[model samples]
Target: MQIQEKIAVVGGGSWATALVKILSENGAEVNWWLRSPEDVAHLQQYAHNPRYLSGVRFDLDYVKPSTDLAETVAKADWVILAVPAAFVQQALTPLAQDAFKGKTLVSAVKGMIPVQNILITDYLGEQYGVPAEHQCVIAGPCHAEEVALEKQSYLTIGSHDIVRAEQFCRLLRNRYVKANPLDDIDGVEYCAVLKNIIALACGIAHGLNYGDNFQAVMVSNAMTEIEDFLHAIMPLPRNLTGSAYLGDLLVTAYSQFSRNRTFGNMIGRGYTVKSAQFEMNMVAEGYYAVQSIYELNKRLQVDMPITTAVYHILYERFSPALEIDILKDKFK
Candidate 1:
């Protein structure tokens, strides 16, 4: 597909808003799908996302907001899925396979589907028959709040087809955003999921009174944990130290804007899982990711102490303090 082809962005969250902001910079007429017609109307009227990144206004000339999924997807040659992973299935349920046919699909969702235990790319292929070549993953050391501030940020776009990846990157790249192309789409997407789990662990450590000294060690070990798990599953030749892997981990683990970390902080501070989720009013993807990884590991059985600790605290109803105390013995 050409850069001039009509593009659609799915979802109405901060990341989706940031992406639409990036697209608007190029003066592209973007078809956007939101579940709430009220949100669509608000965006159209105010030229800004009502719920997220409200400070970043849009150019109405470049945005066509709609609530109809099939109509929006059918109109665009490229579709970017930016919804929270937990909601992506529901988001796509209304669209038939024909809507995705011949469309270049990009996944900005970092978390996996809990029920399927697969990557977003994999899920689309399985559920909608979208080919691997048509799929791409957008990963970041970038956050929406920072993008809204016009700060320089780097994004790694991973696809089996590097040319398509580069084309999509061109659509997103600008003064404040730089995009790099890579062939390890599977590895990059998996790292994106794994890092959030690690970030939650970092936040929990901080809330439990663990200092930077301990966190530094945990993060270093988290990197190793991520490498082990991805390599075991994909066995690809990859540089896990790259920005898409390590840099993403560092930012999410420490960023004040990370919802996963914030969620873990609440859990560390003694909020029950349900209570923490309720209070956050945001999806902490790592909470779902840790469980998916735990189940996937039942067969792979990689020795992931960090993921196990998170899984225990999140799923097994174990005390975060006790689980953390036990986790300390595993760290070097």
Candidate 2:
């Protein structure tokens, strides 16, 4: 008998639940690190995800949801970090002592760290003691909503090591999922985070009943800003007008499945940021990411007009109506 490499999924959220489903389909042994003992016991006892990805059930045979981080990643060959970017450091810190030793680490979180103003991978390497080459950033136009449906979605598994990127892609690729490889880790991560902010702006336009033509222009202008922003951070090319960039922005900005878009709709309908979060009971990456981008724009002296508008609407008591008009003017 041969032993297969184990894959541990860190986080018990919707995205984790969905990825577990896909990883199981990929024929890998999965250990899901639950948020707490209570979550582990509840799912272990009921075999269902009641809190986050409701209506989806995990097959417990090769999948074990546990609260023990050490036990989850102990012998796993590949560990996927699926927690919100806000919680990535905290989640990985407890295991930093001895667990995950010599294991490949992959990140699915898109938002940036507020203090460091860097992507999760950068923070992982700079602050978390993970070897830079061992870190792989899985990015692109992927949304958990599509994964939950077992629908086809493409991802760019980016790393400095092309061989490792392709290896992980082989582990993650599936019928409904295509894993493409990329050499630009920072560029992909930046696009992933900024696209969320861009989408929040588009969602506001949509909730205000702005038509498609208006949104097309808004998204185009936002992408241009994103291209400029990406080039400023990483020397990667700024052809963000493509699928990985535009495709993701479309789903995040327009889809009903986007939590950020949903958050935007609520805000456009007269809900505060805090209230919107409490109502959703799920992590809207954009809500947490806005703080980082707002500070970045101020520090870099770069004009991320959309993020600035969202920051005003969210914190400064600027009317969404006024913000919308001001944003529209920037493109013209």
lDDT, model 2, position 120: 85
Tens digits of per-residue lDDT for model 2, 213-322 = 87788888887788777766666655565666777788777777888888887787788878988998888888768778888777566777888888888878689878
Counting clashing residue pairs in each candidate, in order, gives 0, 0
Score candidate 2 by TM-score against the native. Answer: 0.94
Candidate 2 stretches with Cα past 4 Å from truth are 1-3
* Candidate No. with top TM-score: 1
Q: In lDDT terms, which candidate is top? A: 1
Instruction: State model 2's lDDT.
Output: 0.79
The weakest ten consecutive residues by lDDT in model 2 span: 92-101
For residues 1-332, what per-residue lDDT tens digits would candidate 1 score against the true structure? 12455889999989999998888777677899988988999988888888899998887877899999899998888899999898989889898866799889999999999778999999999889999999999998989999999999999999999999998888988888999999999999999999999999988988899999989999998888888898889998888789998999999999999998899888888889999989988788998999899999999989999999999888888888998898888899
